[model samples]
Target chain A: MSLLTVGSVAFDALETPFGKTDKIIGGAATYITLSASYFTKENNLVAVVGDDFPQSMIDDLNQHGVNTEGLEVRVGGKTFFWSGKYHNDMNSRDTVEVQLNVMENFDPIIPESYQDCQYLMLGNTAPSIQQMVIERLGKRPKLIVLDTMNLWIEIANPDLMSLLKLVDVLVVNDEEARQLTHEYSLVKAAAKIHTLGPKTVIIKKGEHGALLFKEDRIFFAPALPLEEVFDPTGAGDTFAGGFIGYLAKTDDISFDNMKRAIIYGSAMASFCVEKFGAERIMNLTQSEIQERVSEFVKLSAFGLA
Target chain B: MSLLTVGSVAFDALETPFGKTDKIIGGAATYITLSASYFTKENNLVAVVGDDFPQSMIDDLNQHGVNTEGLEVRVGGKTFFWSGKYHNDMNSRDTVEVQLNVMENFDPIIPESYQDCQYLMLGNTAPSIQQMVIERLGKRPKLIVLDTMNLWIEIANPDLMSLLKLVDVLVVNDEEARQLTHEYSLVKAAAKIHTLGPKTVIIKKGEHGALLFKEDRIFFAPALPLEEVFDPTGAGDTFAGGFIGYLAKTDDISFDNMKRAIIYGSAMASFCVEKFGAERIMNLTQSEIQERVSEFVKLSAFGLA
Candidate 1:
């Protein structure tokens, strides 16, 4: 099974309590591809960048078996750039700048070879674009996971809702889940959001962990408790990559498999926060990933009387 | 194996996002006794109340097999009364009023009949008061569990540290743990806190769940996802009751037994928040608890691929 992800591929300047970083290779697609690369080699990338985007970054993804044939580059424009400073808690942040130079008119054009991808990840973006990608697919993928934020729910709720109906899973933070449902309790929020369309709803709580709700069943996978959270820039997108990547590798959508996927995703996310702007996750090895997953197992697994 | 608990038995007026409650029978000892009562009938309660405290509440505890012989009644004095209003998110609250009338001068006198108790729970209170109770015990219990909050740590840091040195286990919320150790990450906080005397530290995250840390080993137990959280008051004490109650019933303090205790505590707490005050947990049956435990089992139990 091949995994295809579409979202921002740009530059980011991050300032965290621990330290700050200048413009580095960062974006939803960048994080996703790196995390997913750990699970499988059959990965396809789709996004619009600009001439300012570094060639070395592209080479990094290509070397990881991520096909960039669908990556569109506009010669005269600048790549999307985001600059943010994280608070002491690392969970909250202040956006210093957002330059959507090339992404302003992003029109994802799916390549013919990418048509056979069995898994699709729609990173945080406009709902219309997500719908366009779904429509262009000749046949529905085995699983379509959609990731969105409070911005889309506030500006394009109707369109987002329509797009939600076409996806298999929806991932949003706890606050966004509540905002989308007007419910404070995550359990209530999941109930209402599941009724909105998707069969499964994942409410991410950052350091607290993530909750997976499907019908009458719920599974919780805790984020590995760390000594410090250096940066939380692309933790969510990295989580999505590991989740979909694991699913593609296993080719199983069962809840049991999804539970492991959540753990794997959580492990990937734990590494993402240990460095400034996705640096730690980029160098994660298979053994390190397994060690983190085992840590999660130890953290959450307990024998009951 | 008899369980002995020393804390306040008073009334609370709580205003939450869901609704408001009149003076409800509350207090650390009250919630602990009720939660522990579910596991065993050998519970000895020691606390101070006043004439204003109703006999009906005593009768309620007596009905649950909680011995009230050690409960001291101060005639013509007011009971400890606390009034708090929860924020819109329900994760935080503001203390509107705190009248430590009877509790101000509480000096717990352990009854001769309770002297044989083997398990002890020192609920959140003034550090001096908690230490006094521990000193009054004729013999050191098999396990001594202490609960404290930021208030005590801020006002009585030296005394609190002394008391921590005497206890086998420490229970605190995430924020309190952070405050006590001046560590931001909970994992780091637990590591720092564990070096301060207690062999085990349980960090409660309220709706998120709880983490039990012993040396290098850690276990995470998730709070049962509920559709509504009517009131969160006393949920932590309730959890402590369930936890210590299970340990007393089984008379084991091994790491495996501690894991089971945390799960039982998590299950009881899940019921505690389903209704206003302790209304939902007050009449929970064995079957109801079993069902909730099964739900918790499903929520956290998953096979790894």
Candidate 2:
């Protein structure tokens, strides 16, 4: 099965309580492709970069069987750049800079090869761009998962809602879920969101864990407890990558299958936070992924007396 | 096995987005006793009330096999009265009024009949009071679980830390865990707290669920997804009750056993929020609890491909 991901391929400067990093290979698509690459050999990536973007990063994705044919690289423009400093909690962060470089006019064109992909992952991006990707696909993929933030909910709510109707699953953090549904209880929020469109909703709670809600069924996937969380930059995207990658590999959208997917996603995200940006996940191997998943199973599985 | 719980037994007036209730039977002991009562018939409750406290509420405990012989009813004093208003989120609340009538001079005396209890639960109360309960227990129980709030952490850090030295497990919410350990990550917080004395730490995250950390093993239990949360007043106490209650019945503190205990605690807490204060959990039956446990199994269990 093939997985298609659409998002930004850009640069980031991240500052966490543990340390700081200079320009690193970051962005939704970069993290997603790297995390999912461990589970599957075929990754169709649709993103926009610029002349300043390093060829080494693209080559790394290419080496991992990521099809960058759909990626648009502008000759004159600079790559999208973001800088953020995480607070002591590491759950909240302050955006110091958001330089929309080549991303300003990002018009993703899904190639024919990518169109045949069975799975679709829309990483955190503008609602219009995500909708355009869906529109460009000739046939609806078996599963479409969307990752969005509060900014889009505030600015492009209508457009986001329209896109939500087309997706099978919605992945968002707890706060974003609350903001979108205007409900404080995540269970209620997931219920209300299901009415909006998607049949499944995964609410990611950073270091705490992630929840998978489908119809009346729900599953909780705990993030592997780590003594030190150096950086949380790509944790969310990495989680999405692991989630969709597992689902695509299995080709199952049932609630039970999605539950396992959430655990796989959480396992990948736990590794993502071990290093700054996408460094840890980029070097992650299938054996490491399997080991983490086993740890998750131990963390959650217990026989009742 | 017998379970001993020490905390306040008072009257509460609460207002939430769902509705409001006036002068309901509340307090840590009330909720804890009721929740624990589900697991076993023997519960020794130690708390202070006053002449103004209603007999019907006391009778309610009697119905659940709660031995209130250790309860101190001040002849001339008034019952502890508390009133709080919950925010729309239900996770946070503001105390509008607090009248600590008879509780001001509460000197818990473990009755002779309750002294042989094998399990003890110290619900959220003054740090010194918690220590007093520990001192009053003639023989060390198989396990002792203590719950406290951020208030004690701020005003009685030294006392609280001293009290921690005697308990088997410490239960606190996520914020209190951070405040006590000075660690932003829950994983790090649990590690630091384990060194303080308690062999285990359970960090409660309200609707988000709870985490259990013991030695190097960590377990996550998700709260039941509810359609509505009428009140969250006694949810934590109820969780503590369920946890210790299960432990008392099993008489095992192994990491594996504690994981199941956490799940039972979570299941009881889910019922706690379905009605105002402790009403829902108070009237729950054995079959009802078993059914909820079955639901939890369904909610969290998934087969990996």
Report per-prediction Cα RMSD to one decimal. 1.3, 1.7
Q: What TM-score does chain A of each model score against the native chain A?
A: 0.98, 0.98
Docking class for model 2 is: medium
lDDT of 1 by residue, B148-206 (tens): 98889899999999998999999999999999999988889988888898989999998
Model 2 C-alpha lDDT per residue in residues A52-159, reported as the tens digit of each score: 888888999998888899988889989999999999867789999999989988999988878788999999999999999999999999999999999999999999
Q: List the residue pairs that clash in candidate 1.
A: none
List runs of model 1 lying over 4 Å from the truth. Answer: none
lDDT of 1 by residue, A157-228 (tens): 999989999999999999999899998878888889888899999989998899999987999988788887
Prediction-by-prediction clash tally: 0, 0
Error of 2 at B204 (Å): 1.1
Candidate 1 docking classification: high
